[model samples]
Target: MKTAIIYMTKHGTTEKIAELLKSKLEPGQTQIFNLKKSKLIELDNYETIIIGGSIHVGSIPKKL
Candidate 1:
């Protein structure tokens, strides 16, 4: 199955978590995207889509 792991990190914590999660999944079947750097993400192509973000104060980033 194809998977997409999309995330946003404030201090790199979320990115590390995403990488860890990807490591447990099938090799070469998972891809990661950083919302702060990646402008365009095509979700339709992925069989499973995972969205992750870091919490700041009381909420996640607005860009998410």
Candidate 2:
């Protein structure tokens, strides 16, 4: 199955966790996207999707 993990990181913590999760999962079509840098992401392409972001003073990043 195709999977995608999209996240925003202010201090790299979220990026690290996304990498760890990707590594622990079984081998498959998995792609990680940094929302702050990604220009376009197609939600329909991935079967499984995960969205995450770091909180800054009780607020998550807007790009997330």
Candidate 3:
């Protein structure tokens, strides 16, 4: 199955976690996107979507 790991990180921690998760999944079947850098992401193409973001205080980032 195709997987998309979309994430937003403040201090790069969330990006690291997303990469780790991708490593555990099937090779070349997973793709990662950073919300801060990516302008347009076609999420409809992915079968499984995993969203991750760094928590600050009590909530996630507004961009997320």
Model 1, range 1-64, lDDT digits (tens) per residue? 9999999998999999999999999999999999989999999999999999988888989999
- Candidate 2 lDDT, tens digit per residue, 1-64? 7889999998899999999989976677889999888999998999999888888899987767
TM-score of each: 0.95, 0.91, 0.95
Superposition error at 22 for model 2 (Å): 0.6
Residue 29 Cα positional deviation in candidate 2, in Å, after optimal superposition: 1.3
Model 3 earns a TM-score of 0.95
Clashes of 2: 0
- Candidate 3 stretches with Cα past 4 Å from truth are none
Ranking by lDDT: 1, 3, 2
Using lDDT as the measure, the top candidate is 1
Superposed Cα deviation of residue 60, candidate 2 (Å)? 0.6
The runs of at least 3 residues in candidate 1 whose Cα sits more than 4 Å from the true structure, single-residue gaps closed, are none
Clashing pairs in 1: none
lDDT tens string, model 3, 1-64?
Answer: 9999999998999999999999999999999999989999998899999999988899999999
Global Cα RMSD, each model: 0.6, 1.0, 0.6
Query: Any idea what lDDT model 3 has?
Result: 0.94
